[model samples]
Target: MNNIDGLDSWDGDRDQSVVLSEELRSRLAPPLKIGNFSVHSRVLQAPLSGVTDLVFRRLVRRYAPDSMTYTEMVQASGVHHARSLKKIMDVDPAERPVSIQLFDCRPDFLAEAAEMAVAQEADTIDINMGCPVNKITKNGGGSSLLRDPETAEAIVKTVVDAVHVPVTVKTRIGWDENEITILDFAQRMQDAGAAMITIHARTRSQGYKGAAQWEWIRKVKQQLTIPVIANGDITSIASAVACLEATEADGVMCSRATLGNPFLVGEIDYFLKTGKLKPKPTIAERLICAKEHLQSLYDYKGKRGIYQARKHMTWYAKGFPGSSELRGKLCRVDSVEEGHALIDSALASLA
Candidate 1:
């Protein structure tokens, strides 16, 4: 029980896999200190464009309290030019140790935006260089920065100098196979004063396809002295273990995997700390969580939050049979009452 420090309130039957080997326990339990903030858990929430809002982050936090979460990647230009983009900075003051990840090629805008993120009480300012979307890459941001390391370093340097909080970079292996630049790009960012780095382990051309080349992350980690977090293809306990063993990264960052199963980040964190695997939740629990997730979004975004909750519901609806049907019904429910009805029907059927 002393090993599992924070589960006194957990009602579910505890899994005994909590004892970690001294080697892995030592390796896995490394805390990341980025500038002024120290992350108690190394499992980080990657900045998904539309997915990692304040509500979604809270859901993940319930399970993984110390796991650091990120905001949806904001556009530096948008933050400077549009109040709409600035809205992304709005987060609960309790969501400390959260990073506001931003993207843009403009050094000046990045500096100003980093300052704004500091105002929002962000734990750190992260520059996103791994996004492969054409919109981000075409404008000289995201993985496109991989193709131009000089600009990437300048962006990091400007932001680091502008804010008291640590500056971090999340990036891919390279622009593509032909332009794999992670090793060099990571070095430049660190030299420019980045406190730590996260590598998603795929090239720009790979997009979200194929296995994340975690080997590239190993290469980057070998070259960097600061803490390096390994990402990509880390959806389950097995993959998380494999990636860490392969790359020797300081910690593992979870991205798309936390979609519906917010408990997964916590599950993995628990496994790392105690070396135990918890059983996956039952359908009843899943539906209850889905309803809670929806209500939280509605509380945060009102009616418009329904649209956002739809995707999260769909993700949670997976791993069991007939999930597609549940997803279909969820998509049509526009109001909280309607949404609760849909969950009720789904839970009944599952039961």
Candidate 2:
């Protein structure tokens, strides 16, 4: 297999040591069939709230056109009453194989929202049962659903009945360490009409901490016949390969790692398909991408996009000399021009 430019194979990490077998390669090479729908790439871009907007998805799609991308999670109740669609649910006609993720405890509301999502050209309807935010869970949404399997199952069945597209779920292992009930929860979801499931491998309490317990993913994959996509801590091609081998999962999804690096999904997809690594972006190249991200954010969402771009800009300005300093300044950028100038200055200094 070929290695990424400027980085050693496995990035010199011994833990990433493993060989891709012919069997595993064969499984991943075929299009991932979710119920009746098919996705050409096994690597998916997770529906990150406040991050996986149109601008971000465009960047990722440029690199991994065949990969399935998701819209940010939208509130089912919010969509139920609104006459017009929420901006979050908007899908460009060109971005095929996009899933619109919805979060709520009300089966009726979720069913209604799924219809709206389908009307907006969503290829699939994803129930967000894995989000760990306090606001989301307090209202009986997100990871809190792990503790309420009956409600979660009902939501899936209702939405499945409501939409023509396949219904999928994204969830954690359980509410906490002591409550790792994904085995039962996953089986219930599949039985209730979910076409596919993505497991984050962390409990609700872990909240993005600790190592993702991929063992649970293996267990879930074994119990369910539906497509299982392993998520959490998938930061690189090596990690993606490691997770797939360890869990024998049907696919892998990139979450936090794709925050600034939209190229991640495509890179992994290319490796999986051809056994050749995509080159890592240089400091200059990354900064250029960052500048483009800032400009697009401003163009798409105006000043509010600039505020959101702050976090994205900081995510990109890392790993190089003076990057920490650049991050500090970039996060406070008040205008698109300012963001462009700062990234340009950092690129020049790196040269």
Task: Give the winner by lDDT.
Answer: 2
Steric clash pairs (candidate 2): none
lDDT of 1 by residue, 142-188 (tens): 88898888898889888888999999999989878898888888899
- lDDT of model 2 at residue 46? 93
Model 2, residue 110: displacement in angstroms?
0.7
Clashes of 1: 3
- Backbone-clash count (model 2): 0
Off by over 4 Å in 1: 1-20, 83-85
